[model samples]
Target: MVKNVGAVGDFDSAHETALLTATGRNQLLDAMHWIAEGRRLNGEVDGPTLLGALVAAADAGVAGAEPALRTAVRAALRSTLDTSADLVMTDGIVPPSRYEAALANVARRTASGTLVDITGSVVMAAQADDPLVIEALGLVAGLSWRDLQARAYARGTSLPGEADGSWSPSQVFAAFSVVDDVVCGRVEPQVPGAVAARPIELLLGGTASGWAAAEAMREGGVSYGTLLAQRDVGSAWSAHRNRSNNEISRLMVRRVLNALDEAGVGYWSTEGDAAVAKAVLGQRAGASGKPPGQLSIVTRAATGGPGYAVLIAIARDGGTARKTAATLLQLPKRFNVPSVLVLFGTGWADRGESDDLVRAFGGRLYTEHTLEQLAEAASTVGTS
Candidate 1:
């Protein structure tokens, strides 16, 4: 018997009050259709066939099977979209380009409504850690959940949940657990081919692991502040932050190197100048030691200037910018070279301080975020 497939009613009539706009709804529907079609092409039992069977079951008077068949098609469509999201988080799977575009559209729709919708901010705050929202943001922009969390933590900015009564001790434990895992090498960095890809997936997987740790702690009746007070946990987070900053700094350094190479400006590793490299390493040394790789380069100075110029990427705590600036300012006099300090990963909380440092550095300061300007400066280092 031909089982009826559940209704394929118009989306607008079905989800009129959905947070997504009409355009967003249509895009999402199209993506769902694409997924279903792919399944059909792959010889999988498509949604329609499953719905048809459900409808047949309902006609045979299977209890509770009527509603099941009534909206089986629509529900499958929605579930397919959710499955795509889940795959992104759990397996680092990227959805098809069409589905990614649809997610981007939906993210834009939600972001635009955030200002005017009464419950918009609240809803966003509540779902700040949600995997779907995280994936959606990643699709729209390069920002991943880990990037957001790192930025917030770096800047000492409170998340919406932290101030909106939604924060829980469990989240605190989870955060610490994530940091600990990173420090312990349980979550090794996987540098994707593209800088902007799959960070959200990695973060989601880490978060899942963190939640498992949190659950175990809760079962053991650990107090809220217990983990916070642990020196090892605190140190782990500090290490994690340092590592994150170092990664960003390295990327910025690569950009500067590329710019210098393109300009045919001769540059060499700081190792070429032993005294300068030793001094810089000494200046930047911390509990964990100097950052793993070379962060400074020696290049030709302007024609009428000193013999050499030093380009250095400074990756340190934001609060230490002032002290770091003071130390760096002496490089020109002590080393007899013009020093350019690129403040890498300085956060919002210390922006004013960094700006002051930049001004005091006398046109020698750049930031990781302003690579174009930094590149220009690098290119002109020997000519200007």
Candidate 2:
């Protein structure tokens, strides 16, 4: 204690000579005093030795700061901690200790392995859920952490302050969210669709319910066709019913318009596709026809994912039209557009062209792991 060591002297002794009360807390105070006092030249007794002691205390997840520990931490992290940039750690590389671990912590994402690498551009994550992180990881982490995500930086871009790369509570949660956007045909593999997982969230009424609806379709047994037959696609947007592209997101442009016309949601004089049609639905059904029960509405769900088998896409007479649709699907997904909405109203296409859309993606759906297993696929994608 300071008093025991005579730092506070006998001032308290005069009041109570027998006092030995302040030992423990006062000793801690002494450590703090020496730490703040700096080197011996600052009108204090201790030098770097005292300061080092204090930092050691704190570095142990303890109570004070010590110069030795501070220097070691800085030594290890000086390259990564600048305020101007992110010391991004990817591919499950754990961050190095101390100064390197600035701000918050991160966990490996469920969709992490699903990522792809593009050539260029730089973007900072605005928040943990911010889409920018997805853009960065999906495009940037080509080789190593030191590789600079520089490819992300080349085309005149910089990381933003809000980018926070965090994940859901469990594998099930993470898988479920991506599934709704991916498998249940809600979100597809467009440049924009792949940019962030939240576009599907924006559609389907932005309700947790609609999101759950999307998830239900992927859990392996539920059939979206059957559900559509039993229920209805609400005013809220719906997914592709199977995968990202049916060449259908754009086609939905017309179908949605027809629905609007029938509902008397009011009519517009303009003869062109409305602005709302410009957006894509997060989901898609590789097949264009109605499910067994639902007549007019298109169905996108999980079973269609496993129903995927390699089949020949017999080309149709509407070759150019199908080609245009495929090209159209490429755009929004490439740019990370939310809905792509490619195949929205494309029912009149030559039957052979429809088969191509189904074949290409269906072959991919298996590798995509859209459904867990055939037995569970129907129940998960089939039931309510």
Candidate 3:
């Protein structure tokens, strides 16, 4: 009962149902054949190519291509199912029932034509079922689609159709390939805690799920050094370290704000705006040299008590820590308000560098790694 949409070599009147031009028809047939052969060889489907071809055919009003498209979809789904089965058997991380549910979700989404990137969809489904699947997948896959889009934009590569809220299958698959490579141990993260911090960076842009993921990682004793011995964290962070720093900075700000809120402290904050820093601290530029360049957080007690200005910095080692501390020391003199330094991350080069920061901040230094201590410290200034 199925019509062979590719059997006719040319566009002829006899094939009235085939509305595509001869070239278009040929390309569709070729892509379908390639995907079938690929699946046969290694259970891999060239989903982007096949999906692109199908989309092109539909755009060209080729109604006859539907049958071939359906067949290709079936093949792709089967390939993913097979791979999931193997993962369940080998890693035992994904349960069979969970895989089945994920497959069913993919099937429905694909049926509606909203899920062109089959592999990414599968990984996303697994992520929804268990966020830890991201770690299990070597921390390369399972990023939310929005995070993936942001990362792509940061890399100066805009995924096709991203503006319309539809993901291009090719771009999604290409990103997923990095995950596959990491899963296979073909790539590794350059930084020790980059794996744990990546999701935090990507999801820090106002998503509660991202904050939950960070909290979960912290409670589970997962840190940047937690997976230092694992050889499969992927190099996404190193490849985009500059962007990662900005993201981590944002994450740190959010963490501090959240901690402050939990401690019932009333305060206002800003991100690197010198004017706001001057206004909140009520400091004039005439006598003081200038507002600090990286004035991250400025807050006062709701009852009009003494305010606190916080400078957040990230230091990977003792040298950077010392340099950051020295820089931080210069800013407090410009402001009459009390100043605090909130340092994030692990791996201080030496205890002395931390001591210098504490002494510089007048014993008001806080580390984000300790949330409870951070909250307790933050509560000191504004809750009087």
User: Clashes per prediction?
Assistant: 0, 81, 2
Candidate 2: list runs displaced more than 4 Å.
Answer: 1-319, 328-353, 360-384
Off by over 4 Å in 1: 1-251, 271-295, 301-308, 311-317, 348-356, 381-384
lDDT for every model? 0.39, 0.27, 0.46
lDDT of 1 by residue, 1-384 (tens): 111123323222222222112113244334233333332222223333343333344445544444433333323322111111111122233355543443333334443432122123332443344425333432222233455466446545443332223544444334433333442235534575533232232332334333243233323444545434443323433433433553444444566667666766655544345556645543433203332233366554455333334445353444454555555544544344445555443331233343333333333444434444444455554452
Candidate 1 residue pairs in backbone clash: none
| Deviation in Å, model 1, residue 295 alpha carbon | 7.0
Whichever of 1 and 2 has more TM-score, that candidate is 1
* Cα-based RMSD of candidate 1: 30.0
Candidate 3 off by > 4 Å: 1-236, 271-287, 349-351, 377-384
Of candidates 3 and 1, the better by lDDT = 3
Q: Estimate the overall C-alpha local distance difference test score of candidate 3.
A: 0.46
Evaluation by lDDT, superior candidate among 2 and 3: 3
**Top-scoring candidate (lDDT):** 3
